[model samples]
Each structure stands twice: as C-alpha cells, then as structure tokens.
Target chain A: MRRPISLALAGLLLSASGAAAGPERVAFPAGYQDGFVRYLDVDRPDRKIKRLFYVNPAALETAKAGDPLPDGTVLIMEDHPVELDGEAPRRDAEGRFIATPEVTNVFVMEKQPGWGEAYPADTRNGDWDYAWFDAAGTLKHSDPERYAGCFNCHQSRAGRDFTFTFFKYVEDLKR
Target chain B: MGRCLALAILFSGLASAGQAAEITVGMAAADYTPATVEARVGDRLVFLNDDSVDHNVFVPTAGHAVDLGKQVPGARSELPLGKAGAFEVECVIHPDMHLQVRVVR
Candidate 1:
C-alpha cells in the first residue's frame, strides 16, 4: 500500500513539473536578419526601456524616402519579461505596442566592397552599424562628436552583438 | 544518534539563516547605474527593470554572462560573480548601454 501511494505522489510531481515547463524552442524565420540597437534616454535612467529592433536588409532602400523606418524593418518594442527571467518579449500598450524608454536606433546594412556572394554572414559578420535617431527622425551618425559618444558606449557590446547590449534578441545565434 | 540529529538540524538552520545581499543595477537611457560597481568576488549583482522598457545584460569577454534577455518594467534579475576581475556589462537589446563591474578579491 505504501509503495502504491509513493508511486502516485511521484507521478503527481512529474505532471506538475511538466506543466510548468516553458516552450521547447523559439524560431526566427529565414531570409531575414535580426539585431538590436541601444541608446540612453535623455530624460531619466530610472524609467526607460532599451529599444530592440529586428531588421531585414533585403527590404531596405525600397522604403519611401524620409520614412521613419528603413525598408525591411520590423521594429518590435520588446521588454524583458519577468516570468521568463531573461527572455525579451514584445509588449502591447493600449491599441498599439510601445517599447518603454521611447527611443529608436537607426541601422543601415551597406554591402562591403570586396565581399562576394555565398559569404556566410549574420549580425556578427554583417557589415552594418548604427546611428541614433531622435524623436524627430534625424540621423546623428554624421556628427563627429556624436560618433564618439555613441561608439564608446557601444564598444562594450562589440563582442556580443556588434552592439553594446541588444544581442539578447538573437537567442539562437548566441555562442 | 540524538547528537547527529541535532547537528543536522543546526546545519540546516544555518543554511537558511542568511539571505544573500542583493544589489540592483538599472539599465536605462544607455547607461548602467552604479556603473562602476565594487564588490567582493562572490557577491551577487541584481539587475532590475525599473525602466519602462526591456534591457539585456551580458558580458562579452570571459566571464559569466547572464543574458537577462529582456526585462520589462518593474522586473528584476540576479547574477553571481564568483571570479574577481573587471567584467564588461552591457545591454544586448541596447547596443549603447554600458556598465563596468570591478570584482575584487
């Protein structure tokens, strides 16, 4: 009788554990590349979310001139989900989704001069970098002073994301 | 046998007695608060999501990287630094956010 009771208890525990498990895998579709760019909120540090952007270079250049987003870009406002511990997720606010911190990163993927087709590349090996755009959609990369200020901050993330801290979105490519 | 039981109880009590000290580092607007942190080798650093959006904390070099993948507002994360050295801390979601950790021996 005791043995039967113990077995039942064990089975119950196993079921509970299975129910609590998260998704087995997350998939990012092919034909697109993903990365992120970070910026400091000008207002206050205590109340901002780092902006995360997912991009597809193939659709770029075709975008209308002066559009806030480059072509082939899907800007998902993601925040760290408390329940998932370290995973980043998109959040919905009111009718639309707004990423906390209210900032946007501007990235352009220009083809390197000598690279031929069949070159294996992703965010890490891609010939892309970023510039910060203000709320008004002005590009800040051309300013020499701005470049240093931005590059210095991003230098830390160079190894992980070719960025400062936005590499968490590429969960599949992490080494 | 009674002596052994008492020792076991005492050991268990000790194990549960002390809560580790938790320090929260906030990443916002592209910077790490308490950017220069000083702590003993075994101390824990808790990265909090006080900002309105998500942030990712990771180390690029040879150290423990806790990819606090994406933290939403009012959330928090914790990572233990067991080795003593300077670890570069940054948010992967924000390429420009940076923080430095000075782990002392």
Candidate 2:
C-alpha cells in the first residue's frame, strides 16, 4: 500500500511545473509630508543661489503642468557644488534656505511611489544615495542609469539637515 | 548616572558617525561604473568621477532621495545610505549615464 501511494505521489510531482515564487513587492516606508530643495551657487563668494522651487510628488502626474504647484508640495532641482566661504545660511526672498553649488541635487519628500515602500531609515542610514521610479509599480529592478542621474543631483545636500532646501516649504512644515 | 551618560554618548556618536562605503558602478567605455550596488543599512556609496565629463546623482523617492549635482574629473562624491531597498542614480545632462544602488537593513 505504501509503495503504491509513493508511486502515485512521484507521478503527480513529475507532471507539475516547479513552483516559482512571484516577484517580491517592496514596501518603502512612508514619505515626508511635503518639502522642496533649493540649489545655491556655492562656486560664488556671495553664495548666490540659482533658484528655488517646490517639489510636488503629485506633479509627476502632470510633468507638463503650467501653473505653480499647490500648497504642501515640493520642488526638485539639480546642480553642482559652488565655491563659497564659511557655512553661510542664506535665505531667498521667499525665506527659503539657499543651497550651495556643492548641492548637486535636490528632492521633495511629499509622496511615496506606489510600487515600493517609503525609504527605510535603518537601511541607507540618512544618506540620499540613490533614486528610483516604480515604472511598472513593481519592486523589480528599474533603469539604474536613470536612477544614477537622480542620485548625483541630490549628493550636494548631504549636510545641512540632510536636506537641500527644506526651508522653502515653510508652509508645508506648518501643516 | 555617569555610566548611563557615557553609554548614551557612545551610542549617539555611532548613530551620527555616518559610516560610509565606497562602491564603483558604471560602464567602462561609458561615463559611469557599477551603475548600481547593494548595501546593508548604515552604509554609504562613493561615486568617483572617472570620466572626463561631470556627473550628477539624485533619487526621486520620499525621505531617501538626493542630488549630487555635478563634479569634475578626479572629484569624488559621497552619498549616505539612509534607508533600505533599491534606488537609482542617473546623470541629468547625459541621460544615458545611469546606475542603481540597493540598501538592506
């Protein structure tokens, strides 16, 4: 009886395809409420900041939006390190923090990508190292080169509260 | 109390020390290397500008995104790993130049 049952089981196994687990969906932790990064021309002596904008993750939906972003939105920008003197805390006409040219990149922590989880704090340990987009809304590998472009831009904000231009989003912070 | 304070100080130092790791990812003929890397929590990735042109890096995610902006030859850029999971790095100017980095807690 045991031999007959064993034979039947083996036959069933042979007929079946190896069960392969589906792709793992990663859940990034939640993102910040709303913020924008400011880029400064650190290369100059006066620490002249080029511009300031709000980073609105929602804008991804309308990359071609014409009007200014809604409240509680963030703006993203990219640039290189600028030469300047001591840690000058400069603010723009809008009262936002000015980022130095050394600030190569900028980002806003308003929304999380639907595919992945919010960045895990314990993982990268407070470093803005990389960028990604869940194009397919799946946690699988996306384009790396595209992501690298994003990283290089954000590297300049390593210091200054680990943020490039959070001061610009003063209204967002109040929320 | 003294012992507790000392332990707190030590822990704070370790937490804020910002431990970093050097990783090379890019194409040889291309202007980048290692394009992407996987690291544990509390690690860092160093991008060395091996190419003649300048390169910028940034992320588009919440809380963990950055922009290295641009760098010239022989200049090195550093990024801190603040979270777990996969992130992308790219060059804004040379859209073709790209890389990926993964951090695990």
Candidate 3:
C-alpha cells in the first residue's frame, strides 16, 4: 500500500525529460501590476508595443549586481500596444511611446533555488522558471519550447546573473 | 557524339559548382570574429560561442528571419542557407554585434 502511494507521488514530480520542478512551481503573481516596483519601460516603435518591466519590491531592495538575484526573486513583464495616431505611434513629451491601458500579455520569470532541475543541462537557467499569464492573470501557453526561450535568451547574460534589466535595477538600487 | 561530350562537361561543371562548404564563425568579446562570411547556396553557417558569456544569433533579413536561440560558452549551432542573398547576423542580447554573410549560388 505504501509503495503504490509513493509511485503516484513520484509520477507527479516527473517531467517528460525526467526533470522535476517545471513551470508548475510558478503561480500567477496576482496584483503584481500595482504592488511590484516598476523598473523598466521598453518601447518598441517598430512593433508599436511597449513593455513595462516590474520586479517585486523585495528583490529591488535586496538584490545585487553581478550576483544571482535571491532565490525568491520574481520579475514580471507586462506588454501593451502603444497608443497610435493613424499609422504612427503617438509619443509623449519625452519621445517615449504612450502605452495603452489594455495589457496584451503578462510574462513572469521567477527564480527559486533548485528549479534548475526543470530543464536539460544545456539550456537550463541557473534557477529561474518562466510562465505566461493572460491579462486576467490566468496561466496560458506554458509549453517548454516556448518557455525554453526564457532560458536561452537569459543564458546569454549569464554574466549579469542571467538578467537584462535586473542589473539596471541593481544600478538604481546603489544610487 | 559531340553533343554527348558537351552534356558531360555541363554535368561536371554543375557538380563542382555547389559543393556546400561548412563555415564556422566564432563569437567572442561580444563580437563575431571574421565578421564577414561568404557562403554558397546550400552551405551551413556553424556558429561557435567562444566567449565566456552567453550569446545568440538572430538573422532578421526579410524572408530569411531566424533566431538561433541562446548559445552558452562553447556552444555550437548550424544555420543552413536555403537561398542566395546577403543577410546580417546579429545577437539578440548584444544588439551591436553583427555578422554579415553574403551567399551566392
């Protein structure tokens, strides 16, 4: 009887590649839009899109540059279609695109120690897991190949502890 | 007999014209060394990440866009040239790093 229950528990943790700790480890960070500290706002005039990057204030207060962010670090990327005039993107006084209120998608990259086991060795990010949630905070499109991009793109920045904007946030933290 | 000899020469020329070589480009110092590569149609571009940091290749040339996602140190990936044209290879993370490859049939 004990053996049967243990077998079922083991199956729950196993992934297709025999790895544990997949995207299930990440839950949608409800209310992150307002509660998290906005760190970066990237505008893509080419696509008429704007991305608002946010990090949980806890990480902004504690993380350092050139070092892996703390295990509990949670970073959120919110994408919006920029406000447009006819065919051109309308810009604010600073020349930054004016972001529309309706969010297109929300992507979250969260790190926790030992989460590295979720991916194969070649593409595994140190300890980060990524998830896609709709604007309503419902998780969607959680395929490994799509999520693999998070590891692949971030892996190139291994020097910055596998982050692009986080180091900038760290820079702001120092000042 | 004369026509047969001409056909044989034509076949030989076609066979020798496109051998499809494999060219390796190394990435280091956040740049692709030998930044310009010349390749023939059907050839392959082998990208080797020689840098200590991570790098990626994205060729955004119209009709030939491809993203060779994350390459860690010592990593290698191959991009096959299916058409003949000049395409610019760039790193998604290090936007400034560029490799120009001119392909011909």
Candidate 4:
C-alpha cells in the first residue's frame, strides 16, 4: 500500500525525524492522486473555484458519521479554476461553473498515530500534518513557520478530528 | 428539484437585513470564548486575540470564506457574515481554538 515518496518530501521527512520537526511527515500524493477517491466538489465566488476533494480509501472504509477519521487517512484537495469568459465564468444550462482540467494548486492532509508528537499542543492537529504543492506536484514551501500555520489553522476543527471536510467525506461514503 | 438547485435558491440573493449587530469573540488561553455562536445574516464578527502568541482567523466556507492570516497578539479583525449558513471558524495555529457560526435570516 506504500508508494514511492516524493524526493523533496522524503528529504524533509528524514530531517524531521532527526531534528527539525515539521510537515516533512506529509508526502506529496503519488501521481498527485493515486489511491485517493474524489468525494466532494466546492464552488467559490469571484474566481469560481471548483475544488475537487479526494480522500484515501482507508478513510472511507473506517470512518463513521460524527466521529474522527481513522488514523493514516490522507485527504487531497485539488483546485481547478473554472473556465472563464472575461472575468465571469461561463456556465452550462444548469448554471454550474465548468472546472478546468488543469489543477492550479493541491493541498495534502494526513493523519497518523503519532505524527503530532513533535509539535506543541497549540499547533498540533491531533496527528494530522499538512503540505502544499503546485500544479506540478512540487513542494512550494520550506519554512518551518509556513507549516506552523497549517497546524494552527486546523486546530479549530479539533472536534472533527482537526479537519473541515472529513465529515462530508463520511457522508459521501454513506451514499 | 435537486438538492443543489434548492440550496442555490436558498442562499441566492441578499440575505434579509433588519438589524445588523456586531459580535465580539475573545481568544485567550489558546481558545475562543463562546465557541458556538448563533447570529443573523449581515452581522459582523470582531475577533480579539489576547493569547500570548500570534493567532489567525480563517473561514473557508464557500462564498463567505476569509483568511486573516497570521494575526499577532492583541490584534483584531472583522468579518461580515453576508450569507445564511452554518460554518466553522478556526485560528489555524491552535488546535483548541474553534468557532462555530450559524447565521440565519
């Protein structure tokens, strides 16, 4: 079930396990989405962001409604800006924005049994860690401070296992 | 009608506005006081961070999402709730600090 790790993420993880603890624990999803299932789509304003949310099969199988996601769950968010005419997006007859096939940004969130042990309580998302990548699946940040925000931001969702969308994924699995 | 179409009609157009008020949220002890709030659309949220370290305010709920990134201690930010829905707000830096907002017409 383990795939080849991204070289950049692997290098960071090597460092994290030794001394510098950070999001190095997270790996860029293989093929940007291998072994992940797309569960939800969100449309934003202005830019018409059509976000495709993918969750690891482990999460789908083990998750229960209104409960925390199982450990080792990996969630990937892929941003596909809607096709636009001028500043407004062109829609089909149903008035739904059409998302471009090209992904603009990707965010990865993963949870393990002891991943948060290196972080302090204030910045730990339980055992979850976050990493960001560009369309080409290249890690875009190397600063420790940058990863700190990921933990801090997701802290609010502690009641939901520190995730904003895992419940929706569980709901999707039900259907 | 489909669920999406029903929701589209529900959230579309200007949310009803009779009286708009400001709600204050205090961040201290690495937590948001009154973690759950029930308010009306067109209301404004003011966040005051009194925690020792820096905190943040981010809402990624579709049309109303806002990111007041990297808010230092003693900082304040305002967010206008323009839509009627249930959404979650987080400091992003702290796991225990979260705010649940339910805005109704």
Q: Using lDDT as the measure, which candidate wins? A: 3
> Which candidate achieves the best TM-score against the true structure?
3
User: What are the per-residue Cα lDDT tens digits for candidate 4 across A124-153?
Assistant: 567676778888877878554666556655
Error of 3 at B22 (Å): 38
Q: Native contacts recovered, in order, as a fraction for each? A: 0.02, 0.02, 0.07, 0.13
**Per-model B-chain TM-score:** 0.73, 0.69, 0.82, 0.77
State how far residue B61 of model 1 sits from its true place (Å): 1.9
Which has the greatest DockQ?
4
Q: Write the per-residue lDDT of candidate 3 for residues A68-100, one digit (tens) a residue.
A: 688789998888998889998776653456788
What's the distance in Å from true for residue B74, model 3?
A: 27
List model 1 lDDT by residue over B1-105, tens digit each: 334434533443344223434456765555677577766655578776666787767665332333545677677776665666776776756766777778665
lDDT of 1 by residue, A66-143 (tens): 222232233222232121113433222211113444334443322222211111122112222233443444543443
Backbone steric clashes in candidate 2, count = 83
Candidate 3 residue pairs in clash (backbone atoms < 3 Å)? A156-B54
Query: What DockQ, on C-alphas, does every prediction get?
Result: 0.02, 0.04, 0.05, 0.13
Q: Model 4 compared with the native: what TM-score?
A: 0.57
Off-target runs (Cα >4 Å) in candidate 3 are A1-20, B1-91, B95-105
Clashes of 4: 6
* B1-105 per-residue lDDT for model 4 (tens digits): 234323432443234557676666777787776587777866777777767789877665543444566778788776667668887786656655678989897
